[model samples]
Target: MSTSRKKSRKARASRESSKPSKRTIYTAIALVSACAVTAVAIGLSTGDSDDGGKDATAATGAQPSLPGALGADGKGAKGKNGKPKKTEEPWDGKVKVLGDGSTSYTGPQPNQPKAEKLKPGQQPPQFIVFSWDGALQGDDRLFSHFRQVARDSNAQMTFFLSGMYLLPKSKRELYRPPQHKPGSAAISFATDPHIRDTLEQLRGAWQDGHEIGSHFNGHFCGAKGGDDWSTEEWKSEIKQQYSFVQNWKTNTGYTDIDPLPFDYTKELVGGRAPCLEGQKTLIPAAKSFGWRYDASSPGDFQLWPSKIDDVWNFPLQLLPYPKSEKQVLSMDFNFLYNQSGDSTEGDPAKYDEWLKLTRGGYLNGFERVYNGSRAPMFIGNHFENWNGGIYMQAIEDTMREACPREGVRCVSFRQLADWLDAQDPAVLAKLRGLDPAQAPDWKTFLK
Candidate 1:
């Protein structure tokens, strides 16, 4: 045979051997496409199953395993009964719930005590606090910027680190050093060295007058199987949170340091909820654990008493920073997008809307408190929001404008709690006389 013919035959054989067969490629494509369709269907249903009886699929056995999953009625797909499913987009619907403007103050009037009156231009007792909740892995640029901003502002912020973020050596190195020991019964994240460093960084912040608070381990509330967790599971979650902080104190050679003495003073004391879930379950649990306040309720931009208990409840007072919300929502979207693993950026318009709502909300809160001497301002935002420089800058700018020397006095949550604790017993008695059910406007107490 000619050399050219031999080479041609050999090349044909090699090409045939190297490439996947047509049937195999087709089969792979079909599988992937099927998954993609299934995910898209799921994305469209997003939390509908949690709405109780409203979701038809939930009524049946066809409940959604993820957010945006189609209901059993096949709203997002064809029904088994041979009908077409109703389709919904993730962002298309409006949230039906609205905030009740009701005030909590109800009871015997304080005789319209003149002592409740504020002096000219004097602001009511309020708190200006921030939180860094969540594990430190997955986003370095955002956290690095947060550390810088906190240092520059000389602000005392709280951080709630996750134990999962302190994993294998590579993961541990992603964070800054006391490397906590792994898997203590109470403190699950203490085992990793990198987590130790993160804790150390937090301690440094505390030393610099910032606050270090617990973000519970195994309490990613919105994650699969997180919400349905049992009471025992919830107990463990709180134990992990308390243990992480306690262990850090002991292991980092700071056992002798007591950031907040037992005596009442302006100290930092607060926690953010995991996945912003667990208010009903965790609030009582937190009180049992000696936590005086929780920043999980998104009910209002001020502190309130828990419906289930007397522990002070500080809802996330500040709307999420635009970038932070985008990152979080994008994760949800990616789950819908077949876990493509790509992060989504916030739209300019969306960012603007979030800022306007948040900043304006804060100003409105200030005005209300300024008018009503009874309530205090408790603004909150997260460290992860600094992912984009602009969002971070906006938060910093808002803080400077709102809490500057001429602006509102920004007190840590702990400070506010201490101040409340220190008031004369008679004064508290008079304040508590106001009906908590009245939902009185804070503005009513102003001026």
Candidate 2:
């Protein structure tokens, strides 16, 4: 052998001699066995039969056999007749659905004896007003609740919404994941993935024959950290709002299904001021936007052309708050607490009071309007408040009491507009002539 080869072989033998021997291998195997035994004992002590079975399977590669019954085709399993069982139908979970039908706006006139009594085929002056404000806050439970209330009352309500809430932001961050609140469950209402889910819900309401109106962009203002924008700012915001709705329509192919009847032209029509802050500036700005009617005012319920333009102002007659002294006191406290951000302690009593007051106010307002023969009552409520089970029940109860009564017709803004459009030119002209500031009372009109 060469000297170099002998030197290399000696070096290799020395390295091999330095390596650990069978003792180390035995030690590792013993440690692994101890761990497996410990795990099995612990699992058994914990009463985990499955763990024991798994361990046994791992050790032996053996599993308990299933039933040996053969199918008609001699398959592994069989049905009652001994034939191979077919796969079961998918477990379609329960799904909620709404009804389909158009709600009427005009009811049969009150009396028929006198010559001045509404002539046959001559419909009474009916006004339809839609208000959209404060919809779908934290989970759409409120929105859903409001829909149910409206359904029960057979009242077709319109909703106007700002697209800002529909946007993804910290406002909606808490709803992102894991929490699974009502509004968060659907990706359609998400900020980045802004789908037409909200719109579709509204459109479904529309398809079922309800009104869908715009609440304006960034109009959430109030105790909730909402935008405190001016009239000009609001106008700019509404432009964005309009664009968002348009985008949703385009993306969802809703434009193909049913294009919005009113465009920017033809007085794109009804709107409710953000925060009910319908100042003088809003009226003029609304006119400039070619809006034919606005529902934020607290004046008479009648509709007339805007003071600035030909638009109409259908003032909101009632909010879902009670008229009792206790209710008022509670509301005042809640308002203060909410404003101060100290409402961490929710008051169900206060909420109930507010509900009672709201329901009472609605009932009173309805009576006032119907009894006086003024325009239809333009009632308003937030999706947030209306969604409360108690509040929703109160609303349903009040509407049930009022909607079926004489001279009371629950209608939406679109239906009101359509009815107005179909009215006699002279009546419309007379309505136009009547000063909105001091219109004839319902009593006078009815008399």
Highest TM-score scorer? 2
In TM-score terms, candidate 2 sits at 0.51
**Over the stretch 1-447, how does candidate 1's per-residue lDDT look in tens digits?**
234323322221000000100111111010112111111101111111121211111011111121121232222233345432223334323322111110111221111112233433343444456555553523344445555665565455556555333333322221111111222111123335555455446434544555555555433223232244444444445444333333333233343333321111112234665445556666655554445677655333223323236556765332222223211111122121222222224455455554454454345545544443335554434333321333345556656565553434454555555555555544444344442122334444323
TM accuracy, model 1: 0.50
Q: What local lDDT score does residue 81 receive in model 2, on the 0 to 100 scale? A: 50
| RMSD in order of candidates | 22.8, 31.2
The TM-scores of all predictions, comma-separated, are: 0.50, 0.51
- Number of clashing residue pairs, candidate 1: 34
In order, how many clashes per candidate? 34, 20
Model 2 Cα RMSD, Å? Answer: 31.2
